[model samples]
Target: MKAPPHFIRNNEEWIIWLLEAEFSGSATPHALSSRTGISLDTIHDNFLYMERVGLLSIERDPDKRYPEEIARVNLTENSLRVYDELKIRPDPGDLF
Candidate 1:
């Protein structure tokens, strides 16, 4: 497995980890924000970042104009390989 890059943010990694078990590897930004106690904007940013890096595939209507409108965030095939190489798990603190 390829090693996860140091540039990957904790929240980004957490989002990927959560996606693995969410609706068969897909979920909406709102769902992820609610589950992680993170802000929707933050989730959107992470999603975009992952998407830019080829680690995620976002499903949305062609007319959708905002990241928040994303219908589903699916893990890319490469995501699992990177996840396996992740050496750190994000600390959820008391959010759990």
Candidate 2:
């Protein structure tokens, strides 16, 4: 399968890591970078991009956990809906 777009890969990685972290009860950028080997800067930059595209939600609330969180990435519902519109599956794969 063709690799996901470089940007998309980064964004997806971020979302995956963010949810993983949240579920694992750890939501720190440092932890994410350490887990995914995606640099902190890249993660943060792509996060803002994802946020703009509405694929990620970055909210700030005084009562919210991690109130000063730098990011809160996830696959927005719209993103999943868009995926259906552009769906393509790999034929089959084994490294040539």
Most accurate candidate by TM-score = 1
Instruction: List model 1 lDDT by residue over 1-96, tens digit each.
Output: 133334446787877766774457888777788888888777788888889999999898777777647878898889877766553544345245
Tell me the deviation in Å of residue 22 in model 2. 8.6
Report lDDT (CA) for all predictions: 0.74, 0.51
Evaluate residue 45 in candidate 1 and report its C-alpha lDDT on the 0 to 100 scale. 83
- lDDT by residue for model 2 (1-95), tens: 12332333345544543443344422555555566676667777766776687766654445534323564444566655544433442223422
Candidate 2: residue 94 lDDT (0-100) = 25
Which regions of candidate 2 are displaced past 4 Å?
1-28, 60-71, 81-88, 91-96
Model 1: CA > 4 A from native = 1-9, 87-96
Q: What are the TM-scores, per candidate, against the unseen true structure? A: 0.71, 0.49
Best by lDDT: 1
